[model samples]
Structures are given as structure tokens and as C-alpha cells.
Target: MTPHMNTRRAAALAAVAAMVVVGVQTGTANARPAAPDDGSSASPRTSSPAFSSASARTAAIKSAQTDASSTAGSLGLGGKEKLIARDVIKDAKGTVHTRYERTYAGLPVIGGDLVTHIASNGKLKGVTKATDARISVPSTTAKIKTAAAARKVIWAGSGKPVLAFESVKTGVQKDGTPSRRHIITDATTGKTLHSYEAVETAGVGNSQYSGKVDLSTTASGSGFELTDGDRGGHKTYDLNQGESGTGDLVTDDDNTWGDGTGNDRQTAAVDAHYGAAKTWDFYKTALGRDGIAGDGKAAYSRVHYGDAYVNAFWDDSCFCMTYGDGADNKSALTGLDVAGHEMSHGLTASTANLDYVGESGGLNEATSDIFGTAVEFFADNATDVGDYLIGEKIDINGDGSPLRYMDQPSKDGGSADYWDSSVGDLDVHYSSGVANHFFYLLAEGSGAKTINGVDYDSPTSDGSTVTGIGRDKAIQIWYKALSEYMTSSTDYAAARTATEKAATDLYGADSAELKAVDAAWSGVNVK
Candidate 1:
């Protein structure tokens, strides 16, 4: 739970020359991103220069790989450890931020990820590590079997390395969402090391709120199916009040779909489909991400999830998005921002994989809110104009109020407007308010204002005035932090560091963006 296992930094690095070959849970369809089919490491080639352009992604990754290989020993990496490049980003000034996953003795080191920052001249600037501990385990043999370890209660990590066994349990939660919980235990002691839920639940469109929108559908048998051919063949499904399994592919004789009312079953599907397209476009157009997983593969969507379910979620297990009908099945949860929120969960899962509890959990949720609001603004649809309010259209609170207020999160009553010593103890939904408030202050400044006809008065915990940096730069800094600098265990403190580094990389060491990032976090009491 502590940021990056720093307490274990003093652990001696074990001699790994004669390390035993161990079977590690490296990838699963439900928990991790897809890997190569040939069981080879996906490390980027290190023989290229990273030019300063969008097409230089491969070169940037390669540059990072080269740096990682050279700096392993200095970073306390064992001889048997190898770094697998997860992502790489190059700033306009040619600074490179490389994200990597570690394997020791060919075993995946859980929570052993780091981001390395390199100057354009190839000098290593610094490294942000998820754990400062060096890998040192006596043996790779497991004394306790997976079945027995599953019954034991979870224990906290001491930042020490141990050969661990991963047990994946798949089932359904009480809320009818699929669960893919990964349980890790000490291989030798049979004590539970850690357990985390992999399902990142949380979107979409419509003819409902968004009047007369266009859709991307594939031609079917004398009809059109809710399949987007342009964006990785993305499709939308109608769950038809069922809690499990994909119900059916929503189709129409013509491409036209849904009325403003939710009376037609296709109405909800239309909204979901439209929202998915817009969200996809937002990521691609604004952030350069191809899709939810950034592999140019689209995660599908499910609408009308259950009878009056009143919610929405993103399931990494199915690589899909699900939405429910609100009260009386009259309101669908498929707003543009809602769709963006659900899919961003998948984006987070595929990238940072932020832990879904404590301060890290709050960060995970706030990430969705930030990107969800960005998507809404990016779309700029007339009917559902972009605003700082979350879920204003769906009305989850039974009042005409939003589920969250970014400018003043405390307006929702349950959310925190600022961080404190015990902010992590709050529910993630409310603790997220800290970051939400920070984002609002960063994007719109700390003061009274009106945007898109909605009034807001954002306050600062330190009573200091903050100037706006505009949402465009604010979002870029966040996405960089989330994708290249953050890890599974990042908290608010680590988050501030990550964003500062991100800002420096994006705008330079002394840029206004960097200063604004600091002031905004201070306004939220994160510093």
C-alpha cells in the first residue's frame, strides 16, 4: 500500500546466477493486456533513435529499452532480472519517458514496475519506481499450494521479494458484474501476499439525450448491425435486462437508430454506440490512443444491462463496456461523459493498473472522471453540452443535481474538496474529489466563473489564487502521468510527483505548466 515498496530498499540483492526457472503468472485475458502468442518478451529493439514526432513511437520505445538495459545494474536490478517495455512517450523537446515491467529469474515481479526519464541527449534524468526493493528470494519453490493459499487471509507486503503463486478466481459479484480477482501468496510460506480485483468496471450515447447523432454500424443481412467498422470493428450489444452474457447484437433495417425517447430498445443501443464512437475518437484525436487498450482493438459495449440497474461499468474480463437503465427504465446511463468514464477505466487497467483501494483507488476513479469530462468537452455536442458536472443527465441522485461537482466537489456533500492526513480512509468515490477539485482548479482557476452556462466557484485549501492552464494542457499532463509515470501503487503523493515530472517533460523544466501543476495540487491540499 505504501508507494513503491520504499521500505525494502535496503534488502540485499540476492545472487541470481544459479536461479531456478520458475513458472510465473505473467498474463491472463482477464487481468493483463494481451501478450505475443509466441511466449517471447515484448521488449522494444534498442538500436534506433527516437525522433521528435508522433510516428517515432517505436523509436522512442527502443530508446527507452536501450536506456533501461544500460541502467539496470545502477538501479539495483539483479543479473537475472530483465525489463519489458510497457509504454514510451517522447515530449516535443525529445525527452523520453519509458515505462517498464520487471521479471526476476523469468518470474514476473508483482508491483515491480518503474518509469525512466531520459533527456534528449540520452542522459538518464531520473527513475520513478513502483518499488525500491531489490529482488532477493532464497528459492523459487512454493510450499503452499494455490488452493490452500486461496483460503488464507491476505497479508501486507514487507517489500521483500518472495516466489509467489497467483491464483485467479472468476465469479460474479452481488451487483451482477463479473469478478476476476487475482490472489498472490508467498510460494514458500503459503501466506497470502496480496489480492486485487482485476475487473475495472464502469458508459454511452444516444438518441436519448443527444438528439439525432450519427453512428458507425456494419452492414448486416438486409440490415445494419451496431458495429463500427472504422474503429477496430467496435460493436454494441443489447443485454436485454439480463445480468450476464452478451444478449444480442443491436440491429436495424437501416443505419438510422433510436429516437430521443427510451421507448425503443434500439434507443439505448444508439446512445451506447454513439458514445463509444465519440469516446474512441476523443482518445485518438486528443491523446493519440488508438482505443481502450491502445492496440487499435476496440472494447465492445452493452446497453440495457439489467432491469432498472441504474449504473454503468467497464469489465476488463470481457473487454467490454456495460450500461443500465436508470429509474423506471426511463433514463439510460449512456451519456457521452458516462461512456467516456466507463471506458477510461479500461484504459487505466491496461496502463497504470492502479490498485482499487485507498488513495490509489481514489486516483483510479479520479482518472476516469478527468478523462470522462475531457471526452465530453472534446465532443461538444449541442444537447449535452460539456460541463464540469458528472452524470447531470442521468440524475443518479434522484434530484436534478450531478453525481459530482468538479469545481466544488463538496457540493455533492459526500465528496472531499481537499486532501488531508486521513483522505485515503474515505471511500474512493469521495476521496476522488481531491483530484477532481485539483483538475477543476487547474483547468478553470480558483474562483467564481461560469462555463457553458453552468456557474462554479472553486476554492483552494491554502487560500492561494490559482490561474487556469486550460484543459488541453491539463489533460495532456495527466495522461502522460497515468500512462508513463504511474504504477499500480501510486497514491496522491506519488501522483503529485508523477504529474510534476510529466509537466516538466511535456512543457520543460521551468514551464508555466509545471508551476500550475504544483499550485493546483496545493489547492487540493495534496502537497
Candidate 2:
């Protein structure tokens, strides 16, 4: 819940008997991964009529790119502007939604990404633009030098576009995470145009898995390393209570990983490694995604992040997830849901790249919660049954209460159960309650219900009876919207449209699934 940026240089760990220590901070590292080919890619669930194979998905993207190249003018693009395809998704009905990044006069337009929605009949439905501002600059050259700009950068906000200088700042945040602050400033007047910290922080899960867990590790020189060669080479490391740099990789002699207790550092590593693998499997089997970036590479994890740190975060700079010991220094924050939640942040970053503020920020958080819950359910471990509660296993509040409740978020005293004009003004964590509530309602409907021994009593804003559409269907709809219709600046209203469109694409327009989606949103006052 705390926000601070930590500076991280590209650092490596040296292998030791039981650990690898982080040594030396050198080389430059970007705050985030380079723009992925499609930001994210996933085949539709088998039930949906979408393309099921990667080759087919790539072919669809190529076709969409060809169409975008030929129809740029019709899409209201300037003569000098070129559209680069980011992702292309097709619905069960053959409706295509293509996301594109824009470059004007060969310069990247910071907020100029868009999604073009086309119906199965080849009719243009609409286009969602990150910024509605017109893109036109007198010059692409910067009048001010990069050094003179200090800390500002970017082009095209709400008004006309302008050339800007990119200023970079790298250092460690107070919380020990890496920080890469990028500033975009106006080239002509030297005024600040836009700025954002590449590092995002938050707090998660594991010292809570059931008895005897299985971990996938690789053989080292004479021992086994906590590296998952089967799933994109994900490695688990121990920070040794240090706050900075890549810590030592956890190594074992006989390949047996962890005890159920945290006395052994590899115990937390077991939970983290297992959680990462389950989350990976959830995305691959349930959503057809390869990894966090939808690419075949894995992001590593760090345990014992700081002394009693009590938080876990996904840092884009390191392309990894890190966890802290709880307030007691014994409770590892690495729960199953926590791992899914943190990793989902990387998924959001890779795809929509939603600005982590206001309504979009709320959606971003909700996206993680939704998928995190899905991952838990997918894992379906008897020790950790899936539920709509976030942070239930971690015991973050010291009491047995969860961090947030989806069925009725107000129980948290801070989260909003329904949408309102002022919801956007609230912290993103609380605003996320709106979407979380909607998701719960859509998945389980209103009124009292019990699943996996967890009871939920969700209410409706309009007092209308809402029927459940099942979590599988609900998750599919949300995933479709996020990867296809939603953009960086999409808010509650836009989210409604995106999900409705997604439902229409997956199920028929008049199908019960779409109706449930509408009712659920209305239940949350998103309408």
C-alpha cells in the first residue's frame, strides 16, 4: 500500500551452498520491458469460438495489421502518421478488435494508442483512443537539450502534440525497490508535459501452503537450484534480509526443497516457486497465455525481501516479483492468491499498461484481483480453496479479517461497493471495489450463497435479482475485454462498454451471459 521507487541496476547473484548473494550494482536497466509484439496473447478458452492455436492468432494479427495499414486514412489517421499493430483479438462471432500504437512523423505518440472494433459483418463498430487529442507538431526536433529538460517528457496529451525531451532518473526507493523515473517535457517552452515512475509498489502470500508441496527445480553444479526450467526458466532467490540488488539463488544439495516451516529459507522459496508455477499454469491452461508478457519467458521471484518488510511487489525494472517477511518476520507474504495478484500486475503492465491513477488505476487493481482469484480457483489446492476474498491467507491486518471483500467491499471500511462520481477520487485500491463487487456478482449473483465453505451475500444497487453466469464465463469476458477492448485510460463507463462488447463477442448479444454482465455492472452502479 506504500508507494516508493527503488533504484536497481542490472545485478546478478553468485551461487553459494544454500543461497546466492546479490553482489555489485552495475549496468543500466529500463524500468519496464520493451514493447512486446502484442503486449499479450492468449487463445480463447475452448468453449469460445476464437482461434485456439498460436499460429492462427498470429495470422489473425497479421491480417489485422494489413487491414490497419490500408485503412489508416479511413480511421482518421494523419497522412504522416503510421499505425503499429500491438494486438488483434477475435470474438466467437468473428468480430475483431485490433489495438494499435501511433507514430506521427516517425515519433512515438505517447498517448496515441487505440483499439478498433469491427463487427463480424465487417461493419466498423467504434474506436477507443487513449487520448482524443489531435496529433500535430510543428517540428519533431527538440528545442531544448535533454540535459536542460531535467525531468520531463512525452508528446500528445489532451491538446496538440509537441516535441519533448525524455529525462531519466535511476536510484533506489526508500522501500528498496528499483526506481526509474521518466520525465517528458515540452521542447519549446521547457514546461513539463508528462512524467511517470517506471517502478510500481504494493504488498502479498506464502508460508501458508498446505502440507508437503512439490517444486520444480533445476540441477546445479552438485546441488539443485530453485530454477524452473519447465516454465520459462523462473528462478527463486533469497535476499538474506537485504533490501537491494538481486539476492542469492536458493540452492539445495539433494533437490528436496523446503520444510513446511519458515526455519529454512528454501521453505518460502518453495511457496513462491510453487505459486508462480500455478499462476503460470492458470494463464496457460485457462487463458492460453504463455507467461506474464504472453511470451515464453518467465519472471523470477525474490523471497525474504527486507527485514519484516510485510509486502510483495512486481517490479518491471527487474522483470521479477519480490516478497517481504510479515510484521512478525515469520509470516511470509507469499500466499497463492498473493502470488497470483502480484504476477497479475506484470500481466497488466504488459498488456493495457493502464495508468496507475484514478479510475484506470482502480481497474488495474481490480484486474489483478479478478485474475488472482481465478488463479486460486484454478489451483484449487485443498489447503487454499478459491474465494473472492483478497489477502485472506496472508493475515495482513493482524486480525483474521481479509484485506478486501468482493461480495461487499464496504466491509473493509475503505473500499467502495458501488460506483459513483466520487469513486474515482478515492484511492485506487478502494475504487477497485466497484469492479471487484461487479465481478463477484457476475460470478455468483446476489443474495446469500456458499461455495467452497466460504459464504457471500452480495447485494444489488437497484434491488434487482441477478443470476450467476459462473466464474469461468465471467473470467473469460473480463479477459477478453482487457486484451481486446480496454485501453490505458478506460474508466468505469468505458469498462462497462468494453465488457458488454466482450460478452457480446463471446456469447450472443441477447445471451444470459451478457445480461448477467449488465445486471452485475448495474448492481455495482457502473451503469
Candidate 3:
């Protein structure tokens, strides 16, 4: 099997457009972070006007150190309480409690008591005035017209990270689209490079990405085909399939392509197209970066990677994204959160570039899941509504439970929301709890609350109250911490170090941001 074909029943092929999945077989390996272990994309962005306030630098530091020494560890914590208060801090915006007591990337709820209290160094600003905050559920679900009149209108002069290109003379299909034999143009130079023949499987046409092509069809011969000029011309490519899967041949480059929508391939296509577009927009607009790599780098994703693959991942060598349809017993693994999570692997690769082996690996995975949830909120799709719940739409386990939960990571089968010294050694899914809990406590505060009819009880190490600053502020602090302060081998303690630094840097030690950070960590039992 190719590097992309790790131990799944089928593998994907994106010759020009992600097409179909060819059935195969394989061995299982330890679950690892699906990000490329290359190119330090995690380095902080160019620090535009985004990173100003050098004047308050020293004051913030001294205040942060004093708050760290005074507020944390004063509360004796264990279990859920410890998890809730993991790394709380305060800042000018008020106390921004870490959201997850043990979960990562959970929704944020902001509002708390004690706006400003005198720290050893001085009084922190932006402290919460009340301890109660509610979820800001958005009521907007307006759909926009995305289908363009012309193919080029949707794809021409688009922005994505494409390093190099060459042209080939390919052919046009009966559908009036370019085939493999049609002439290709270089994206950068607008020059013709070469001519080639289309791989004949009958009706495969060209797409904007894969060019005109039909990799396969239903027994009835009506299904989805590639659109020319897809994601700057790329698709999942599989080399073999069905009874055709063999020993020497199976291990060969027999990659095909398939969509994740079990019922209709077109549905999957629409979702993928929309999901990618929304994700790209979120990062570009909210964070002010080019793309995943902050350099306009574009990556291709292949759904239905292997038969019943049941998982999604990213690989470094290929710089590709892959997902599975499902087993007869299971459902497709492609949900908005799943898509967001997988893409986050790409983001993690470019920044902090955390190791994907053990504890750090768990942090890496949680980061993807965390950011993935946030991206869902950013999209606000109706069919795929935004919530703290992950995999709400994709019933992968058939239990009505999502793949992971930000408010309570443990609600899922194999997630941990709190951090013990040993948590970093657990599965990445579980290890993610530390950060998850941190975010939860930071955004929502500690104690009992009801959201969307779901019952939750956020606890803190000290009996004192933590406040919520919402997910928006929490995410920014975490992003800054990850990109600026975190390094490989960082465990729960290290995360505290990083996030505290971030809170102080972004808001100020004496700012409400720092106080919230301190309280949030305390709620997660991080103290």
C-alpha cells in the first residue's frame, strides 16, 4: 500500500478530482496525529498590528507572576474540580475562564463575579462582574448562493497554497469538459506545458481540480463526476479495487476516490465543497492568515479513503487529507466537525508543530478537535448546526453521542477532559482533556449550568468562582500560547506555562484576561 493506504479496506485516489475508493485490506497501527511532521507552520504569524502594546509588557509580566503565585494552588483540588481550574488567568476583558475542565475546544460561556481584585503586584483589570453567563446561540442561518454560472468564475484566480505546476495536453469528455488528453495550463505562468491521455474507465471527465473525469459509476451508470479546476486541480487517486485487490497488486498504487455521503455522492461533494470553503474563510477572516500554512498552501482531501475506514487523517509525505465512508454497521465519518478536525491537523502541522507521539501527540489531536469545533461555530450551517458537540450529525457510534465533547470530554467513549500527571501518556483523544478542560473553564466558568437543555456541572479547585469570557477570547489566547510559548514534550504543566504567558502577553497580568485565565484553570483542577 502507498503511504496514504495505511491498513484500511480501501484507499483513495485524487488524480484530478477526488473520485472513488477502491476496496483493499490492511493491518492496524497506533493512532497518531495525522499532521505532517514537517515545516514549522506553528511559528507565530508576522505579528501585525495584531500584536501591539509593548508599553504594558513589563507590567503584565510582573502582575502575571504575582497572580500565578497567589491565586493558584490555594484551592485543594481533585478529579473534576482540579480539571476545571487547570490554568485560569485574568485579563482586561474580564476573567476569561478556561472552558474545558478536562475537555478541549469546547464552547465558551463568559460571565462571572469579582471584576477586579488586588493581586500582589497590583489590581487585575477586566475581572467579571457577575458569575452567570449564558450561551450566545446564533439565530442566523442564511444560505448564500455558491454555485457559479461558469466553472472559471468559481475557480479562476483563486487563492490557495500551490508551490509548482506544469501543463499537459489532455482531452475533453463527451460532456464538453477537458479529459486527460486535454491541454493543461500552468497556474503561475499561464503557459501550456504538455498533452496526455485520460485514464479510460469509461466516462471519467475533467474537473477544475481533477479536470473532467469519471473514475467509476453506479451499476446504473449515473453518479458524481469530477469538476475541472477543483482545489486548483487535485483529487484523491486510488490504483485498485474490488476482486481486483491482490497481494502484489493491492500493495501497488491502486488508489481510487469516493465521497463520504453513503446515500448520494453529490451530497458529499456539496458538503465537502462548502465545508472547505467555510473553513478557509474562517481562518482567513478571523485569524488574518493566508491559509493553513499562513502561506496560501492548498491541500487535497479524499473521502471514502478505504472501505469502512471509520476514520479521517492527514499525512506529511503527501500533504493530503483522507476520510472513510463507513462499514455496513456504521455510518460515514465525514461531518462538519470531522472535516474541521482533520483540517486542524494541517494547522497544527504549520504551527507549534507539536510532536504526534505521546502526551504532546494528545495535545496535537485535541487542538485539532478543539479548533474543529470552533470552525463549526464559525460556519453556522443549518443542516449542520453549530454546537459544543462533535460528530453530532455523523452518528458514527449509533449512540446519539458525539465523537467528543468539549464541556465534558469523558462523555464520549475514549476522551479525558482533566489532566493527571499520567494523562499525557494516554491516547491523544484522552490526553486532549487538559486543554479541553482549560478552554471550558476559561470560557464558561465553574459550577452547574444548563445549555440547550443539556445538564453540566463545572467545578473548581478552590471553592471560589470562575467566569466566562466566551470562546472568541479563549481561542485567541490559546492560539497565541500554542504558536508562541508551547514546544514539544509539553505536558499539562507546560500547557499552563504556555497559556499563562499567552494570557499575560495578550491581555496583561493585571488585566481581566489574566484573572480569568487563573480562574479557568482552577475550575479544571489544573491548579
Q: State the C-alpha lDDT per candidate.
A: 0.72, 0.73, 0.48
Candidate order by TM-score, highest to lowest? 2, 1, 3
lDDT of 1 by residue, 1-527 (tens): 11232322112111100000000111222222111100012221121123446567787677667866666877768898888887786543356777888877777777777877778898888887777777667766556666753432212145666777778888864334466778777767766667655553221224887787877665443445777877877888888888778879987764567767878888888778888888999888777676886656688988886677666766665677777787689788888788888888778877787766678767888888898899888888999899999878777777788888899998888789999979888866788889989888888899998889999999999899999788887887888889888987899999999999988877788988789999999999887
Model 3: runs farther than 4 Å from truth? Answer: 1-261, 450-455, 461-464
At residue 235, candidate 2 shows an lDDT of 87
Candidate 3 per-residue C-alpha lDDT over 32-110 given as tens digits, one digit per residue, 9 for 90 to 100? 2232110011332222212135444444444544554234233222111111232233322222322122211221111
Q: 135, model 2: CA deviation in Å?
A: 43
TM-score of each: 0.65, 0.65, 0.56
Q: Which candidate, 1 or 2, has the higher lDDT?
A: 2
Model 1 residue runs over 4 Å out of place are 1-206
- Candidate number that wins on TM-score, 2 or 3: 2
- lDDT, candidate 3, equals 0.48
Q: What is the alpha-carbon lDDT of model 2 when measured against the actual structure?
A: 0.73
Give the C-alpha miss distance for residue 453 in model 3, angstroms: 6.0
Poorest 10 consecutive residues of model 3 by lDDT? 16-25
